[model samples]
Target chain A: MISSFQKLTIAFTVLAVFTGANSLHAQQFRPAPNAHYPNHALMPPGHVGSQMLLRGGPIPGYFQPTQVRCPQGGKIAVANEGKFVAGQPSTLNVGLLIGSPYRFKITEIPGLPGTELFPTVELLDRLHPPAGLETRFPIPIHLTAQELRMAAEGMFITRVIYLEDPTNPVVVQDDANRQRFFDVRFNEDPLRVADQLGRPMAILRMGSKQPRMDRQTGRFMFSSPPVRTIMPVKQSNVPEDQLQRAIISTPSIGRLR
Target chain B: MSKTMKTSSRSYLVLSVFLASMMGCITPGTTSSGPLEKQSFENIPRPNQPASLTVSDANSKPIHRASPAAHQQRLPAGVATQQGPATLPPQAYTGPNAGIPYPAPWTPPGILGPFPEDEYVYQGGDAYQLTNVAQDFSIDNLDEEDTIAHYHTLDGKIEIERTNRIPIYAPRFASIRRIDGLNQYRHQDHVYAVDSPLALDGTAQNIGQEQVKQHVSTQRNIGTRASSLYRENQKLRDMAHQVASTEDSQMLKPQVGDLLNTKVNIKNSQEAQLSIQQQTALAQSDEETVKEYAYDLLPYKILANNRIQTNYHYEIADGNSRLDIKKVASKQDALPGELLEFTITFKNTGDKAIGNVTIVDHLSRRLAYVEDSQNCTVESEFFVNPTGKDSAILRWEIIEPMNVGQSAQVTFKCRVR
Candidate 1:
């Protein structure tokens, strides 16, 4: 015979306690020492995972615990904090979930004349990863003046994928066979499997870094915004031989060709 | 004889003798029937005759009554006489004796009184003195004359004495000729040589090369900046034009206006940038010329011959005040965070005066000028780069002329950034 207000107050208290515990647990959880990825060396002090949660429980037709975050949920971020002075060298950090055998291709938004894209190899070196991530790797992107201007205008990573097994040790070399493999497995369109999985696999809207204010602390801090999201890729129902032919005919994969 | 007869006879004899004496006095010389004097004046020298002869023949000849017209008519051809009819003297015989000759009125001795003193006169400008005897007289008649006096006598002599003459003003004529197997009164053309001590120092060539290098680098930088600004300005202009043509919402109008304003500003700034680039190019050319001239003349070699040298030296001291000082970098080297005071001790070592002396120092991108650190005694200007680069130009001009062995110093301060 408890009053509804009292019951509501109890439930709220319980919910607060549960959320606080989860936050504390997440903070205290550290990866194993033997973990392949060294978290302590890679991440900055006080680094925190993004607070966004994906809406769907799991993507269909994709491995569970995909080890990849959807674009809308702030899994990947690009920032140029303290690195945009003109006529001096600057770097762009593209944050991604730590997954080996990954490939990405940055393409200029067509019809934008001043947009420039350096060869992908220069941007995708193994050393010099993104800032503020332990369980993630970065494609350290160096920008020329023209490329920086293009980024300011609006550029994007049109494709990002985790290759299950790459035929070539280096994806940039001998990319035609790799492109064929990608087409056969993921359909002619690279994002077809991602579309079926109902999650964004592409990102856009690169802009200058903005400062965010913490309401409780009354302090300003800079952070990159969540990447732009795209609708799931449309399925093209075609025969297997046609798909194979399409894969062979495809010119490039992740700028590999 | 009776007393009355004797007295009468004596009277008659005395009267007869007196009449005879009177006739002798009246017809002493040839008597003229006209109003002319009844005497001969042949002993009197003509007015135009030399005074030396007149003085010498003073006691030699008897005075004679001569017609002036007859005397003038007797002169040699081409000899000029005073214009108009000549008149006779009232008394032609007027000397020590009735037979002695009288002096002519137009003679030097008569015009200048009994005797004339010797006088020296200069005939040229104040800068020089060319002497001549305007008037000379000697009672002894043993005076000797030089060629200059003879020349002056032929020409008209000036009558002013002069002193304190300069040798340059002396009358001198020179011509090129082969004498003793060498060219005389000839010289090789003079060339502008690098003669300052600063130019002759071993550090000087390095300084010139360094300055040239900096000049080239600065020119390149200016060109790059101008090109970048032009491209940006063009892009902004295009963007503004596109925005203006589009029919956007009212909220976007302010943005469009801003864009247009930005474009105009950029275009205006581009003009300044291009101007700086052109100026830099011209300055580079001048620097190259200076370098070539400095290297070609080889002031060090000239210094070895003791032909050209300088007392010019520069000192660098750093301090917060005049009394408190510390040694800073030397020549063209400096460290970061140094407060440096540069004092250039400028000296003129040449024989003549030097003017329009100017010293220019360009600050590197890593230095900042100290506030109010310029010298008040000289004309100075500090110019900041219009492109917002961290470099500046400093110039000090010495307007007053500096004489030989004269020295001056200019001081300024800068802080390393």
Candidate 2:
């Protein structure tokens, strides 16, 4: 006669064998991390994928000089430090560097008073102009009163400035003094659209976040970042080509003073 | 008397059954065939053609054999024969059985025959068009043990017999007694029982009982073993003595011939040191006085001269222990740490001489100039200046002015950091 202990031992052995057999068929089929999505851009910035596209030297006239044109009766200040007077009808032209972002203060809107908007400019590319003529072809950043009002009213606005494609130019009779721009829906990416149309030059973002600068308060504020200023060329009756030749023949030509 | 009669009857029955089984084993009769054997014979397929028979008397005349023409026809068409076709007789002949060819065609047996080739021919359909595909079978419903179908039931259940029983005659004894081996010992008494046969004590429980005895024979070569051990010890002592004596001799008088002569001669050592010091001082002074300049980008000067067209391009240098140059356009991508070869070509298309031609390049901070990599077709003076870390300024001044229709090129190498 088989005792209870012997019967239990046999039962346990049989159970273990069955368990092992079941385990063989119970494998979890986990796919590889990048097997399905090989080109996934999940990695953060500065990764190898992003750095590979950052080869070659900086574009010509990088950080040389850029002129910022404001609305009429409006004034502009660099980094909200009030560089330009409140009532001055002048445009702020600072030599913004690529690979860095700069913030600016917009004040004295024609219709809206005490409405100051801080906008950030991120330069993605630069123009290749002749030496000492960097200011002549500065990146024109047009801040409309509508965008300023929206930003002042706590609405976010994003504008992408792109260099028009010479091969495929936009056929529009736009004002020579003002840049040609368009609007996109909220769900659309302005930068991507700008790249599709032409070469994306810069990205501008404006919102209603006030500065947090306070003494001994571990606070942050939009302090004016030092920039090289380029003097505008004097108005003359000289031909463009002759003027370029004159500049090239000078002894200190092409050298940034 | 009744029991004996019953026993005899049972024996008779058993003997008859055994004889019957033995007869079946000895004879190959129809009754002895198993189910499998019968089934195999019953499954044999009928032949396609009926067999034919031939009858002849023992004293019949010799039969006419087939002519040589028949034999030649059986041979391959290309094969050469000793006799020509014209000399051969007519090949018509009669088979042993009526109405049959001399060389009958062959066919495989029915059991070994395979399905016709047309049955396995692929039908036209696109296997890659997987849209609206239907799954008709499940893995769970598959019969994994179908290959061994005979061993299982219709439901695929394998029944196992775990218990086995056999008939045996009953014993007369009512109880079973355990038999203790010779290793039995009483722990409480701490002594062997007096009546035990293997007891060492000289006391016997019975007066005339015999005690178990054992006899053993052994042969040990003590003298040979001792002599061998002594010889090994003496050999070890000799080795130890030799090592000790050698060590003592070396300690008392070291061998000079085994040592290497390592004395090196000194010639103008102080002069060499002074020259090295002077070179270091000059390098230090140069480093202290070197001028730094901001980088500026400018197009090739020849772009302004319609008479001379300047072409500037760069190529990636890659190979296995050698340079394999491949041109890369400005829009193409390049990897870091790759070697780049830059070339500037200048051609004179005018009818006059171009003099004092100088070319300068401001290398980007990302590129490091390779040492001694500058090359030029014309005699020129090359100058280099470090603008910043991993950056440099290169300038070349052509010593001889280029004449009409003259072309010159300058090439250099740099590694992207």
Candidate 3:
């Protein structure tokens, strides 16, 4: 009995009401991004935070040896001006050829059990080797009070290396020249040196072998190859003030043959 | 026509009565009328307003009213509604000293006696004595064999007599001198005469002398050649002993004597008196003994009588809970969005009666509390506010009583701003 237009209007009104209700219900059920929920599906196992957020990178390859030579007419001297007590600073003077770019770092090699030295070094300007023709860089080495005390107490003899930056990209003419520069420093046995005057040595790295890594675990399967060449060089005991003059006066470069 | 009209009226009356009864049964206490008229009738006297209309009968007494001044003096509605100040109920005493303040015990610093002074005596004899001689005294006519002799001589002169007597048979004599207002003996000086050559059988004495001479020569030769070798051997042994004792293999290296003089043993053993060069050579070969010697040689101070003692007391107060919480962070400042770990420590600073405790911490909007970071054996949950983003609440309830000096800790992690 209803007219066709009226019936069509009624049908459209009923359809609109149902669709609006359905859309609102769907909106209410949709989860919002960034909302904190009780479920922890994304958390890491063992309650450990992201590795990148916790500790820093792996241990640095601190052991590297570079060739260090005394300038013509001078000798390298590593001297402890004060008594070798804990918290004392020692001086190391190395003679280098003028206009040569060089970087140096000191690394503490663990000695007998309980013997430790905090390996730290101040970097000097490589651009300009000191002004005069007699060029020697006097690097001050500071030992922690505990390290010094341990050394004095004879807990352990500390062995430190006055290493040249082996990673420096420098051009060398021949193997002989490189060998001459890379010769050992402090040739005397480290154990025989005064504990206060830490045994100085050069830790030479011959070459690196390929390292193997596990395919599935992504962890290193094999240890890095060991360094074979550790040549002990002879270090002279020269007064700090006269060290520069001694370098300038010597006619031949003090290189271990 | 009159009879039909009467019947219709009677029917109308009957329908009206039935309709009224039906309306009453359908809706109790409501009338079937126009909405506007019903609203006007209901609003005539508001049910909420107090009844101000006075009802009077023919024999009723006149109503009395309070004056305006009396109304003004009446208390405000808020004051009139409030009950009188409550009387505090008496509390039952739990113990003899309940509700009493106990004074804290006082302790004073330990009184120590003065350090004992070391008694020192001069070991060297008359070398340290100062001498001032005003006059010289001398003795004369001294005899070697005579035990007693008297002589007068010039001032400051002393005679010496040598006797060929064995030490046991020699007579004792004392010489006194005044030094530093004190009398001290100067009896160290004594001289004895050499004995004449003994008479012996000719061949036997000569043979004995020749044997002595040969023995001396052989010893001299061996001494010169083997001394260096023996010393070197001893040094090596000492060094080996040191290396063994210290168990530090790093010190084992070839012997080098260049810096031997500078090397000092931290622990100086009974045999540590060896020369520095020798010790270094020994240390190069033997690690333990050398390390032990070095340790002994180190100048270590002895600490004595430096400890302090203290006593702590825990007291509980009436109706007061004494639980405390301390928040600690591994690092205070971090980069934006960096993860930081936080620790909350709860301590019971008083007596053991402190009951179960509940802790609630509101997470800052900038931080995102990590899931499952709560480290406690209790009911703990993280709740996010429905209307706020990045804001949450962390709640924990501890059901056990925390005793005095007892503490527990909870830890969680969050991304810091």
Highest-lDDT candidate = 2
C-alpha local distance difference test of each model: 0.31, 0.42, 0.31
**Residue A203, model 3: Cα distance from true site in angstroms:** 51
Q: Let me know the TM-score candidate 3 reaches against the reference structure.
A: 0.16
DockQ each = 0.00, 0.00, 0.00
Regions more than 4 Å wrong, model 1: A1-257, B1-336, B376-388
**In candidate 2, which residue pairs get closer than 3 Å at backbone N, Cα or C atoms, i.e. clash?**
none
| Candidate 3 docking quality: incorrect, acceptable, medium or high | incorrect
Task: Give the lDDT of residue A199 in candidate 2.
Answer: 58
Docking class of 1: incorrect
What's candidate 2's DockQ score? 0.00
Which segments of model 2 are wrong by more than 4 Å?
A1-53, A59-61, A80-90, A214-224, A232-257, B1-417
Prediction 1 global C-alpha lDDT: 0.31
Fnat of candidate 1, please? 0.00
lDDT of 1 by residue, B314-414 (tens): 45332211111111222232222346565544555445454544443444333456767866344534333321333455545556655656665556776
Interface RMSD of candidate number 3: 46.6
